[model samples]
Target: MPGISARGLSHEGRRQLAVNLTRVLALHRSILDAYIIEFFTDNLWDTLPCSWQEALDGLNPPQLATMLLGMPGEGEVVRYRSVWPLTLLALKSTACALAFTRTPGFQTASEFLENPSQSSRLTAPFRKHVRPKKQHEIRRLGELVKKLSDFTGCTQVVDVGSGQGHLSRFMALGLGLMVKSIEGDQRLVERAQRLDQELLQALEKEEKRNPQVVQTSPRHSPHHVVRWVDPTALCEELLLPLENPCQGRARLLLTGLHACGDLSVALLRHFSCCPEVVALASVGCCYMKLSDPGGYPLSQWVAGLPGYELPYRLREGACHALEEYAERLQKAGPGLRTHCYRAALETVIRRARPELRRPGVQGIPRVHELKIEEYVQRGLQRVGLDPQLPLNLAALRAHQAQENRVVAFFSLALLLAPLVETLILLDRLLYLQEQGFHAELLPIFSPELSPRNLVLVATKMPLGQALSILETEDS
Candidate 1:
């Protein structure tokens, strides 16, 4: 990927990043698929060089993610000895791809340092009204909308896939902009409307108690409208009716905090084509759900590459959480052990009852803090198998002795997570830039709090026009 998508970069610089992902994923294909082999099936004893197993046997869970990838040199691996030189090849290659994709995927760190505080943007009444995580997202995203709206002279905000209308309520009630909260689920749309009514009532009651109340806005309009509509099927005609009736005309700022899968892409497609859509700030999630008619490659440039097909497994890998995984590993007791059981049980099912393996173990409720013997017993019951059916615990234990291999295999796959997300986002950013929009990615919220922290912020104006507003507002 391009080092960084500086505003100064040419269109070709941004376009080249489109395929940077395809090439990296293809290069690592064999090494990645190697992870699919069951731990008990092959010792992979031959795959690792001499004494590699001895080193692996010694390291703790928290040390694994960084053990191999962070340290490729002898001095580095000596600290966490399990990583064989040969295995380090794939992990090291993935790290390079990740670095390239990540650097260009967003604005520099200083931009985040420059973001206005949540306290300055949100009033005390509004701050207390929302959850902390939600509060952070609202202020961060809200600031983006403010920039976009001011740049395009837009008076309306449309929150797509606005689940439960948290952001919509914040925009309409707190920011004093007209908002149309579009949710795919009708039940959620109704519930969001009811919640808005309750919040308005509460705010009014508080105003009576504290006459000196520093409201988010004295001009606040309680016009938080809810609509049940699939964004893919929505058009400008539908949007006209949803607009704040008080305004004679309005430019719409289309946004989604974490629009799932193809829904976010669809929003971008609509926003790009629709003349009414002046700007957007969409943060996407649930990449595995992204549908691929031609292939998983969404951008035209990436799709044009021959024999390139992104699988669901690759998208699944993209969702891996490095920070969260490390934190889990550091926790006390058998907390992190839960990761290994499900994969091991899949092997058991293949041997014991292959016919029952069709739908898979997704619905199996977690067997919290169970020993291997008890875990299998409870796990069997979860899949509707007879709990009394005895398994050879001794044999399973022998296989469990190689638990380090399982952790190593997963950690290798986890390395590609951020790269996959970057490639996907880069495609979107490049597409928007190609459309003559000043497009860029911005990180919102602490990554530790929210794994998918990046938001694609863009506008249909000259480069300096939109970003200047962000700088001016900051000053």
Candidate 2:
């Protein structure tokens, strides 16, 4: 008979993985402690578990010596031989994930990622002329619009911040709904009108080109018709004029696609106050523009969480390496190794090329300072290339200041990015919830298309039961 063997991970393998994680976590703790010491100088690790000390105590010098003896003859072979720090880092990440999962928001995040219907309007047309990069997203939006139609029994839509009127045209012409596409930017509004006129001209030209095509159904024809209006006037000066003509028979759709900062909040407020509006499908972006209770606005909702606060007068910095890493990872799918490599290469390039320092190359705006590596990766990606060399932790540390200097100029601004965004989203969600609307955050597109992918979809559910379900999931 064959010898019995233990299934799954061997005892040694399990132990090693755990050890690695523990070591990594310890390193993380050390880093956190150092940061706190530099700032607070007291009670640095007060909240941390003392178990870490006990774990370290268990490792004798003999074991460490034995491990070090097996190292390769490379420059950093000794460092590689020690696994304590790596293990601690891994453990820290695992613990963070576990803790995050316990939060109410965590469950909603998972469910929202898995289920679009949680907050989506079923009636929205997915295939608008906007030509969404992702097919699934477009279909989902279409489904949402369809659902909204059924829920509100509305036949008209008023799209706010409508760029080029692509969505509005699709809904009005394809879905046979009346549409009023509003845009704040005069240039975009002009472009949309021009596009509409061009489409009509193209249709007329096509008819002349092939008279026999007249037998085709109008719905099946390739012709498109869209109407464009000024968004700024619509919400303020034009509201009365527009509503007076429609009277009370028509249900309004207050929809905005990636409306920036305060614009989104403004739309929500408008929807709340506008009794004629029956439904809303708004996606907000640029959280830094939002004003908080103290008048200063942030970009992230997490910044406003119980334990988090916006750092005062913090200047944003560009981390080209991070930005490039984020951008490529987003575009290249979920490849962690690739992302790391790209980030590393970026650092090298930034150190080598100081002249290429400019804004808008990678996502790092001129307003923010960026790390060298981040700049390099972004510059590389902008030119459709990847970093040609390998970069490890040692190399990173060797060039830390050079890498950091690139972004150090805008540290405060950089810190504000995530914080401001998190707070804005939280505020928006809370507002929706307060209004008896069930809202879900969905990744509207891949990270590559835009970093602002988290979309809040809110709909009227039966007696806020959906919110209760979300709360239960969080618990």
TM-score of each: 0.82, 0.48
In order, how many clashes per candidate? 1, 68
| lDDT digits (tens) for residues 77-133 of candidate 2 | 334233445544444334333110111222222323544443232223323243333
Where does candidate 1 have its weakest 10-residue lDDT segment? 100-109
| Residue pairs in clash, model 1 | 56-82
lDDT of model 2, residue 461:
45
> Once model 2 is optimally superposed onto the true structure by TM-score, how far is the C-alpha of residue 59 displaced, in angstroms?
25
Model 1: per-residue lDDT, tens digit, 19-85? 5656777876644444333444444444544555555554666566446435232233435443456
lDDT of 2 at 298: 24
Worst 10 residues of 2 by lDDT: 313-322
Model 2 segments more than 4 A misplaced: 1-143, 201-234, 237-249, 292-305, 311-423, 460-475
